[model samples]
Target: MMKTLICNMTTYMPKGYSTTPVLFYLIISSRHLEDIPLQAKKCRNSKVELVIVSNPEFIQELLPSAQRTALLYHLSYLCLAKFPKLERILRERATETQLLFGSSEALLLKCAATSQNLVSTLLPSLKAAVEKNKSVLAIKSLEKARVWINEIVDKVEQMVKRYDKHNHSVASCTSDVLNEKAETEKQIEQASKEVDALEKAVIGLNQELWNNNQEIGRIEATIARKNNELQNHIRESSNKNNGLSFMVCLIPFVGPLIKSIHQAQANQALAVKTQAISNELSQLSNEKSNLKNKEWNIHVRLTDMQLKLATMKLEKGSIPDPVHLNDVQTCLTRIQQILIQIKKFWEAVSIMLEALKDETFADEHFIDDCEMKETFLKTITTAQKHWRSFGEYCLSARGIFSLQTKDAYNFLETSPSSLSKEEWKRQYDAVIVKLNKICPEVCTPKETAAIA
Candidate 1:
């Protein structure tokens, strides 16, 4: 991941990127190297390229993938080596593009997708111009682009093949980080679901507790009413017994039998009913207590789950997203495919130029009326027809140029950041305007502007 505070990428990397702030090397001078006299005599005959690149180690890297993708990593360290603000913009864009599209292949696809319209429209006209009109400038321009593109692509392929071992590939290293992030997300989701379930359970238990409390209150009220009714019934029975039993006292055995039968009176039956209701109330009270305990346990679980989910989410945020390595085969194939079209397209133009340059022999001996002269006229007409076919070949060059493809695969050297026509120029200008509070290049350093 780009955000990782990593050391030298890996043991496999032959060299790590410079921690310097500059991006590209500054040229010594257009003329003699006499500005800095300290070492002028010692390096009077040195190659300018070597002197311009003061730091030899800046361009080299042990990681092949890093070499292909160094612009995403160390250009900030080198070009804007001194400009933190500018470096930061590049860093932001790098991070944005990477996270937005997880794979290099996908990014390439995005860049390549826009080529269809160009092929359908612009290329057909260019093809017509080169074949029918025979424009030399179009041929040269496309040829120049093709040559530059081929050399760059070939170097990339070599680098990819050089460090493509199982362990050396950056994909393996970043995979670990990606795996950690994915696992953290999974854990967070599971904990969140558990917390939600526990919360629902707690709510359900609370409702049950409230309902049980109401049932207990109702049972208690019923018991109170039953007791009052029993008391009234007892009073009535006592009054009746006092009158009848006294009169019936002469018949002692009959009075005793009536008293025994009076034992099943309404008041006694009410007492038995109240006792049963009281037992039911006690059972309900026990059930309410059990629900309370269950709710408390669920509450604890919910809190714990919530904490765990938070922790997992935090971990997920900290783990930087994986920076994908461009697909070597696909990129090479795409580049080669584009080059083939441009090459064929331009080759036709080159042949057309040769044909245009070919004068009609400047011969007075050849005449249209003679059979041999007719042959000469027929040759000219046939050459003109073949020129059209060449035009057709050149027009097939679809998506010959792309800003996205170039940005997706930009490279930089050991120089400081400055305005140049390369893909990173716009970024440099934008950063200057953003941080310096002046339009791009308005307050450009004299030397930086000279270099640009």
Candidate 2:
């Protein structure tokens, strides 16, 4: 179950990297993230990477040494490269969301769901852009998403200034959900307990599955290597046995040649080893598939329980509590949805990019491969990746969305500022005065003096 894990990003670089000569050509690269490391970094707001980093010895619980190390390094690089100011983005996330949606947690969930739907809907377009080789379409697709992203990023600054006064948490608006509907209380409590237990099981199962998949990968890699060795051994034996005089094999020290004659015909030991490894791999794969099904079933049950509990709370009017929607599932909703773009980009990458593996340079014979190194530079410097990252960042702002709709409005009404209160009174008085002047109707802005 051990794998020689060699993680290389070079294989998944943007396509046609060698078509240009300059190391820094104006890259018209489309926004795409077809790389594993990149996806992992973006997944779960980089919690996946955090897990790997925290559990260094957890390689034994996941991938082998080389795979884990490379994955960690690559994911770390991807995160740093894509999300330069991660901490800042995360810190102001909630308040900025509150400004746009006006203390509505439901708005956040809506946006998250909407963003996910958009990405899902746009996937075919993304794939088509790559397939048709229409770079313009790809650019335009990203540009449309870019508008929303910029709006969010730009509006956030103003929102922070606008909503700072209301930043303080509201009073107990959710006492109803927390302490209401006595009959439903038992059902909610039981569901909650069940959800908690199922969540733990799912987490444990997922970890095991991850580790199992890694082991399967290792076994498959070993089988491939062993198969190649077997063929190479037979081929070498045949070559040595060829053009050698029969009398040369009659010498006293020709033991290897005689053995080659037998090995050239059939290497039983190598075959047996490969078969055993192959059988182990097949069994492991089968087990992994079965457990994966079990995991999904448990996940479905957990989701059902969670939904029932949430519905009960919503009906009881306790959803105004921020904690109701401020959980990992909500955070993942945005991240998980944005991950679709990665899949689309990956499809394009796999099709358009040639995986020129390391063996290309095995002989130290550098052919007309001059532009290859520079092309690698293109993958590094491409703005396409940046655009893709930005789009995802924008969509992921849906994380700011929640289910709380009552809290912010409550703050604005109960904790109105002096400026706001005075402005409202002035407007109301002017309206009344104008109504008196114009036979009891609305006010004109110039009628402020008449109102006084």
Candidate 3:
């Protein structure tokens, strides 16, 4: 039995069966031959000559269900086993279409995981399928594919920009590190130069220190030498000063001893001379005492002569005067004795006083001062000569006067009465007055009282 290709043919058939030949032809031509099949026994037994003719709608008809089913089967097999490359393309196209027509969840999931190769291979096919389908669903699927393609391309561009930015940042950081290293090397070189200069200065300072040490050593040596010399000089001076002090201590006693010994010898010789002078002075003192007594006696004799003269004046009126040789001779002898005693007394007194003066200044060295002692002796000699001469002359003159007056008086008394008694007495009185007037004083003499 042969099966018809179309199901439910009766529903699609015209209202009534067509009686016109054209109508039957039209109906048969609208359908595909594969929709039905003839049985073998029918083909063998029938000799029916049915001519198949072309209808206008034959080539432009719907595909039969059987052929459509067969085509779908072939495509599924190709996709699963025979045509892997094509199948991959178709699946990618299908996923793209689904992103457009299916849901937002499917498109979002595909965008996160889709590669560039998947998008490029599938998008064009998906666009072609939409154009061929020419339906609202197909157009929606095409728009979804376009949106995903744009989103992926934009993301890729952003990633490329980010990679470029990262490369630029690394280059900048590398350049900075290199500059820092170069600057550090320059600073190290400068520091090395400074250290070398300081080292040279330190060497110069060390040399100067050595020279200063040498100068100090020389100064120390000079000071040591000077100190030694000064010590020697001080020692020598101390010794000489000690010797001079010893000599000074000995001089006083030695000088006085030698001088005193010489003076004692000279004093011994002077002592003998002084003793002889003392003996002479003793004799002269004795004579001076005797002479003093004789001078008193002479004073008494003068007093007696004055009395006699005064008595003669009183007796001048009665007695007569005469010159006699024997009476003159006796009076002269008495006057001579008194005068000689006076002269001797004065000479002895002078010599004794001189000896006493010499004994008073009896220093051993007195004669060494010759000028003063010679002047003292000259004065003493002049005084002594004047005294001696005056005494001797006075004595001789008194003797002459006494002898002349006595001779005149005796002659007057013994003469023959040649003159009157009164005249004789007057002459005797005048002569006695003359005798008293001519005599030097033996006692203190009387001076005339000028007022009286």
In terms of lDDT, the poorest run of 10 residues in model 1 is 1-10
Assess the local accuracy of residue 452 in candidate 3 as a C-alpha lDDT between 0 and 100: 16
lDDT of 1: 0.31
Report, for all candidates in order, the number of backbone clashes: 17, 7, 10
Candidate 2: residue 378 lDDT (0-100): 35
lDDT of 2: 0.30
Give lDDT tens digits, candidate 1, residues 212-287. Answer: 5455445444433433343343234433332221211111111121232244354566435434433443343344
Cα lDDT tens digits for candidate 2, 100-219: 344323323333343443345433443455445454564455445444433433333343333333222211212222343343445543445654565566467557646654554454
Model 3, 64-172: lDDT tens digits are 2111211222222121222233334333332332222122222223332332322343333333433343233333443454454455434434433443443343334
What TM-score goes with each of the models?
Answer: 0.19, 0.24, 0.19
Question: What's the lDDT for all of these models?
Answer: 0.31, 0.30, 0.29
Give the higher-TM-score candidate: 2 or 3: 2
C-alpha lDDT (0 to 100) for residue 234 of candidate 2: 30
* Model 1 lDDT at residue 350: 27
lDDT of 1 at 140: 48
Candidate 3, superposed: residue stretches over 4 Å from native: 1-347, 350-364, 370-378, 381-385, 388-452
